[model samples]
Target chain A: MCIAPVDEMRKNHMTMLLHQRDKTVQQGIRGQPASLTGCIDCHVTPDASGTVARSDDEGFFCTSCHRAASVKIDCFECHADRPAEMISQLDWKSLNPINHSSLLAINQQSFPYALQFRLETRSMALNQ
Target chain B: MNKIDQYRRKFLGAASAAFVGITIAPGILLQAGNAATAGQGVSDAQRWGLLIDTNRCEPGCDACVQACNKENGLRSIHGPKTDAQWIRKVSLKNRKNGHVLNMPVMCQHCAKAPCVDVCPTGASFKRADGIVLVDKHTCIGCRYCMMACPYKARSFVHEKLTDQLPHAPRGKGTVESCTLCVHKIDRGDNTTACVQACPHGAMMFGDLNDPDSAISKQIKSLGSQQLRKKLDLDTGVRYQGIPV
Candidate 1:
C-alpha cells in the first residue's frame, strides 16, 4: 500500500535520529580520562638513590584511591603488612635457595658470598 | 655565730640535695638499667615453632587441605588438577621403623624459607611472626617456589582463576600453599582447617609469642622435632610423631 512508503520513510527518520543521538552520546563520553588502573598506577617509589621507581609488593600506592573509591583492599592476604623499606633492609632476597646456598661453603660455613654478590652488582653500576 | 650557722645551714642543704640525688638517681638507674635485659623483657625476641602430633591427626583427613583451598581461594580444575591443594594430609611410613604417621603436609612456614629466597619477584617472604607466605599478586609463576620447597609444600596454578574471593582472588600461574590460615589468625581466630578439622586434636595452633600457649607448652613437654633438621630450615611446625 501507499502507506508502506510513508512508514519506511518514518522508520528511516527514526533510525537517523537514533544514530544522531548515539553519536552525540559517544562524543560526550569521549575525551575524558579513563578509569583508574589502581595499584599499577601508584605505590611505585623512587629508590633511595632516586634513579628508579619500583612498586612495593603490598600496593600501598594503589590503595590511596582504593579506599576513596570504596574498593575493598586485601593485599595483606598474601603480602606483608610492613613497609617495603623494612623488608628490603632484611636482605630477604639473599635468603632464597639459589642465593643462600651460594653463601654457604662446602664445609657448610655461612660465608659472606651473598653480600659479595650485591657489592659486585654495585661495582658494576659504578664501573658504568 | 650567725655566719657559722648560715654556713652550717648551706652545708646541710647541700648534703640533703646530695642525699636526694643519690636516692633518686639509683632508682632511675635501676629502672633504665634493665633496658637491655634478656628473656621476655626484651621487646624484639622472635621465637618460631611448629607442632605436628600424629596421635591426634586423622589418617586421611582433607579438612585442612580443603580449608586451605578456600582460605587461599585455590580453585580445583578438571583438566590437570592445577591450583588445587596447598595442604594435603600425607601418610608417611618410616622405612627403617616400619611406622606410619599421618601428617598434614604444607608449607613448613620455615624460618629460613627457601621459597622466599628463590623468588625473583619478592612474592615469597616470612612475616615478622615467622609465617612464610606467598604474595600472589607479585608471584610471576616462575615455579621457583615449587622447586625450592624441600617438603614439596607448594603448587602452581595453570588454569585462569574464576569464582575467586574478592579479597584474595587466585591468580593464574602463581605459586600458593598453606598460609597456616593466616587470614584467620589475623582475624583473631587461631584455627586453620587442619587444626580445626583434626577431631582428635592432633594439630595444635597458637602464637609462639605466648610462652604459656598450648603449642609452646606442648613443644617444651614433648620435645618436638622438625622435618629435615639437616636442612636447617628452622621450620615453625614441629613433629612429635615419636614418643618423647
Candidate 2:
C-alpha cells in the first residue's frame, strides 16, 4: 500500500502525478515517490487471464479508477501501462556500455532511500 | 553580576548556538548533497552536438541507421512513408562537378527550434544541453511539429509498439525524431548509438560550447556546414566536407 490514504489518493492522485511529472520531465528531478512507473509497479492488478495492463481490461488499476471518474487517461496512450517486467527486457549495459554507472545512479534516484536499499539488497542476493 | 552568573549566561549562549546548529544541520547537509547531485542536470554552459564528416561517410553504409533502429526499437511496419526513421543516409551530388557526398540527417536540435515554436502543447522542447525531445505524455499526437520542422526529420508512429526500451519510451500517435540518444546524453554518455556504430569514424559527438571538444575543434579547423544556415537556427548538428 502507498503511504497516502486510499481516499486521499483516489481524490488527489492526479494532482500529485502532475506535480511529479513537472518535477521529473521539466526539471529533471526524479526518484520521487509519485513517479508514474512507481505507481504502476505497486498498484497494477492482474486480470483472470494473468495479464496486467492499463487498457483493454476493466480490472486494471488506472483504467478502473479513470473509467469510474469518467476522466480520460491519456498517459497510457504513449506510456507503458504496466511495470517494467511486463515490458521488453532492456539490456542497460549494452545500450551504453561506457556510462552504465551514470544509468544506475539515475535509477537509484527514482526510489526513496529505504526502497532503494531494499532493492539493492534483493538484487545482490539474486546475483549471489 | 557575580562570576558564576556571567559564566552561566555564557554557557546558555553557547548551548543555544549548538542547539540551533543541530536543528538546521540535516537540512544544510541535504542541500549540499543536492547541490552535488544537481550538477548532473543539463546545463546551458554545455551545448551537446554532433558533427558528421560527409566525405568520410561510406555511401553503402547503413550501419548508423541500423544501429539507431536497434537502439530505439523502431520496427518497420511495411509502411515506407509512415515508419519512424530517426536517421537516414542522404546522398548529395554537386551538379557541375559531379562530386558525390553521402551524409546522415536527423533532428538538428536547433537553438531556435521551429518545432518548439509551433507546438501547441509545448511538448516539443529543447533541453538545456540542446537535445530536442517530445514529452510523449503531453504530445497529444497533433503532428504540428512534423509540419513545422524544415528537415522532415520527425515521424508519426502509425501503430502500437510493444517492444520499447525503458530508456526510450515511444508510443503510437506521438511524433518522435532523433533524440540524439537523449538517454545517453542525460546519463553523461558522450556517444550516441549512431556515433558508436559508424565504423568509418564519420560521426563525432561532443560538447559544442567547449572549445577543446573534438566537434568544436573539428568545426573550427575543418569548417562544418549546417543544413540550412539561412534560417539561423544554430543547429547542434553540423556536417563537414559537403561541396558548397
- Which candidate leads in TM-score? 2
Give each prediction's DockQ, rounded to 2 decimals.
0.02, 0.06
What fraction of native interface contacts does model 1 preserve? 0.00
Cα lDDT of model 2 by residue, B109-142, tens digit? 9999999999999899886667888888788899
Highest-scoring model, DockQ: 2
Error of 1 at B62 (Å): 2.3
Model 2 residue A2 distance off true place after TM-score fit, in angstroms: 4.9
Model 2's alpha-carbon lDDT is: 0.72
TM-score of each: 0.52, 0.70
Q: What is the DockQ of candidate 2?
A: 0.06
Clashing pairs in 2: A31-A109, A31-A110
